[model samples]
Target: MKLTIVSRNPKSTKFPVTLELAGTASTIKTSDVNKALAAKFPKYYPDRQRLTTEDKKVLDLDKTLEEQGINEQSSIYFKDLGAQIGWRTVFMIEYAGPILIHPIFYYLSKFIYGSSFTHSPMQTVTYYMVMAHFFKRELETVFVHRFSHGTMPFRNVFKNSAHYWLLSGANLAFWVYGPWFAQGRAAAVRNDVWIYGSVAVWAWAELSNLITHITLRNLRPPGTRVRAIPYGYGFDLVSCPNYFFEFLAWTVVCFLTTSWSAFLFNIVATGQMYVWAVKKHKNYKKEFKDYPRNRTSMFPFIA
Candidate 1:
């Protein structure tokens, strides 16, 4: 069988390379084609580079080429994989981790270790808050965020899922149903002023985060690549106000639960958000000449 491999680069003058191979090779794989390409064009297909279809679909390297339906005189366009996965897939997996895992820890505590199904007011509120937070995140992943054209590394889904799922389980288990639950609730309500203040702050942060996300979504229409500076709401002060509100919301969770686990989760999450915010802020500045110079990355006037 003969197959033609074409490069996606429009400016390239190089002729398409043809490969002649035995059609009866039972174990022929995509990796074999990749190896052939690398061997044929050493400068283009270097050691670390990967090739994908023209539409950016990653080929199953281990699947047999025959099974993928490559036949004689077929043309396959190859482009760089560039160490990434689809952005929608990334967000879906990341949000799904917490959405699916949090409920297990929240409810499991009730059935295990002689714990009752009944929950205290504080416990109920914290449980609902955690559920609401992750639900909103899932909804935002579908409706409120615009992802640029690209992918993150395929491996990052595992790393991100582990981080979110583990933290969700830890925070909910320790704060809502574990031995620390009673003590944490006691500390939270020791002063009515503190309880009311923390609840108000949490609500405000959650709503503000949603608004910021909506504002960002509105900046770019669906199926368009144009990027404009986001205005109004929290965007006035910070380049990544959505992240700022997210950090604030988690911090408020720590206060509401008075749980060390919640505090630790907030700290770790905030650190990760901060890193992302900084990178995004720099990118905004680099991409737009009119980007607000006075805006910070995450913290207003501090970071």
Candidate 2:
């Protein structure tokens, strides 16, 4: 349907025309538009997700009401902006959840460090909980194709029913049961070095994790049009400085956490990333004969 567009910004002009929603809208009933506006500008309006027309007529923001011959009687209002992103596009192997989640990284980091200051087991524990929670979602999203289920599972998508169940199990384990594993091992001789060191490792590692994950993995970051090619691996860097840095960061976390829980977790998790990085590096060399000869997998330069 053609949407009427207007701008709160003076530089932009209003237009009226029907623009096809291409991976841009899951469903529009005027309610979705209001929800979009509210999410992006919560300060201006309340109950963002609940905004809709009384009679249920959807309004198009891409065109002006005049262009569409919109009558005042029409229930929907044409706002200055459309959804910065559509919910449909968010679910399409890209970034519906990340965009929503990115805003809280600072707070997460703060919480971790703040708890680390007190050396409180409770606060530090909560910090790692969020990481595994987010990481778990990323894992599920990355492997979503393996799963054949959605909110409503279609028969046509049943090919990966097994993968679906497996993903569901992972989701439960990581998000729900992930914390039980984050706790580090107990030691009879607890040194201040180990305690603070683990806290430092977890704090920085997660911070770096946020950065690399966002930069390398974020699909629809702001205005960028290019997708990540798993570049660190394709460069023939076997250790993948990214994964290495992550390990370095987490090693410290293990010290502070002082539990077999974290040790076992990193052993499995980082080990998988390491193996994948090596294979990816090798694949890069095989695929491109001219792969960089000087680069090592995890370490930089010095051949």
Report lDDT (CA) for all predictions. Answer: 0.73, 0.42
Off by over 4 Å in 2: 1-197, 214-239, 299-303
Clashes of 1: 0
Per-residue lDDT over 36-120 for candidate 1, one digit per residue giving the tens place of the 0 to 100 score: 7777767544323454555666656667766765555456677654456777777777767666766666667655535555445
Best-fitting candidate, scored by TM-score? 1
Error of 2 at 132 (Å): 7.3
**Candidate 2 has what TM-score?**
0.36
Model 2: lDDT to the true structure: 0.42
Q: Compose the digit string of candidate 2's lDDT tens values, residues 1-303.
A: 333333333554432222332122333434334444445456424222222233435444333444444433333433332223322223332322332332343234334333321223532443464445456445544542222111222232233332222232223222322333223523223455655555666666556555455445444444333333444432344336667666666555444444454455557657676777778667656766766666665545522
The RMSD (Cα, Å) of candidate 2 is: 16.2
Clashes of each: 0, 22
